[model samples]
Target: MKQLRLSGSGGQGVITAAIIFAEAAMNEGKQVVQSQSYGPEARGGASKAEIVISDEKIYHPKIVSPDIVLSLTQKAADKYYKGLDQNNGLLVVDEDLVPNIPDFPNVVKVPVTRIAAEKVGKMLFTNIVALGVLVKLSQLISLESAKKAVEKRVPPHTIEQNMKALQLGYDAV
Candidate 1:
C-alpha cells in the first residue's frame, strides 16, 4: 500500500486534493481509502487529508505512517512532518509558505502556492497544483487519470486554468 498525507490551511483545499487523488486511484482500478480532519477553526485553520492506495484489499483505512507527506502551510509542516520517519518516507513542502524546514533526507521544497498564484492567476488552484505535484512525484497513478479526475471535480469554466496549473505542478519536480 502507498499512503499519502496532504496538509495545509483550511481554505487551501487539501480535502479536495485527497478526493481527486482517490478518484484518480480508483480510475486506475486501485483500492483506495481517503479521510480528513480540520484544525479547531471553521476556516483558515489547519487541515489534513490522507489517502491509502493498494493493489490488494485495504484492511486499515487510517494512515499510520505516510509514504508521502505534502505540507503546504507552516503549521502543517511543523505538525505532520515530525511523524515521518527520516528513513521511511518523503516530505514535500511549499517552500514559500512553510519555511524553516529542518534538514532531512527525501525532502522536496517547492514554491507551490506561489507558482499557482503567479502562473495560474489565482491561489484558488493550489489544490489542483498540489495534486499534480503529488501524482507526478509518487507516480502511484497515471497523470491522465489525475487530469480526468480534475476535469470531473473542478468547475467547467475553470477547467483550462486548472489543467495548466496541474501541468505546471507536474513539471515542478
Candidate 2:
C-alpha cells in the first residue's frame, strides 16, 4: 500500500485533497482509505489528512509513516518531517508558506498557493491545484480519473473553474 499524509492550514482543504486522491484511486480499481483531523480554528489551525491506497486488501486504516508527505504550512512541515523515513519518504512543501523549513534531502518545494492564485486567480482552489501536482508525481492513478473525481465532487457551477485550476496546476510542473 502507498501511504500519503497531507497537511496544511485549516481552510486550505487538506482533507478535501486526500478525499480527491482516494476517490481517484478508487476509480482506478484500487482499495483506498482516507482519514482526517483538524484543530478548532476554522482558518489558521492545523489540519491533516491521511490516505492509503493498495492493490491488495488493506488491514490497517491509518498512516504509520507516510511514503509521501505534503506540507503547506510551516507547523505541518515541522511536525511530520522528522517522522518521515529517509530511505522511502518524499516530502513536498509550499515554498511561500514554509520559508525556513529544515533541510530534508528528499523534499520538493512547490509554491502551490502562489501558483494557484496566479494561475487560477483563487486562493480557495489552491488545495486542488496542489493535489494535481501530487497526483501527477505519484502516478497512483490516471490524471483522467483525478480530473473526473474533481468534477464529480465540486458544485456544478464551479466545476469548470475547478477543472481549469487542476489543469493549470498540472501544467505548472
Candidate 3:
C-alpha cells in the first residue's frame, strides 16, 4: 500500500485534496481509504488528511508511517516530518512556507503557494497545485484521472482555473 498524508492549517484545502486524490486513485482501479482530522478552528488550526492506496483490500485506514507526506506549512512539517518512512519515503513541502526543512534523501521543496498566486491569480488554488505536484512526483494516479476528479469535486465555474493551476504545478516539477 502507498500511504500519504496531506497536512496544513485549516482552510488550506488539505482535506479536499485528500478526497480528490482518493477519487483519482479509485478511478484508476485502485482501492483507496481516506481519513482526516482537524482542530476546532475553521481557518488557522492544524488539519491533516491521510490516504492509503493499494491494488488489494485496505483493512486499515490510518497511516502509521506515510510513504509520502505533503506539508504546506512549517508547523505541519515540524509535526509530521518524523512520521515519514525513513528508508524510502518522499516528503514534499511548500518552500515558501517551510524554509527550514531537514536535509533528507527524498525531500522535494516547491514554491506551491507562490506559483498559485503568480500563475493562477489566486492563492485558493494552492491545494490543487500541490495535488498536481504530488501526482507528478508520485505517479500514483494518471493526470487524466486527477483532472476528472477535480472536475467532479470543484464547482463548475472554478474548474478552469483549478485545471490551469494543476497544469502549472505539474509542469513545475
Q: Choose the strongest candidate by TM-score.
A: 3
Worst 10 residues of 1 by lDDT: 98-107
Stretches of candidate 2 off by over 4 Å are none
Colliding pairs, model 3: none
> What's the lDDT for all of these models?
0.90, 0.87, 0.93
Give each model a TM-score. Answer: 0.96, 0.95, 0.97
**Number of the top-ranking candidate, with lDDT as the measure:** 3
- Candidate 1 vs candidate 3: which has greater lDDT? 3
Question: By how many angstroms RMSD does model 2 differ from the true structure?
Answer: 1.2
Kindly report which residue stretches of model 3 are placed more than 4 angstroms away from their true locations once superposed: none
Single out the weakest 10-residue window by summed lDDT for candidate 2.
164-173
lDDT of 3 by residue, 15-94 (tens): 99999999999999999999999989979999999999989998977997899999999999988988877889889999
lDDT of 3 at 120: 97
lDDT of 2: 0.87
Runs of candidate 1 exceeding 4 Å displacement = none
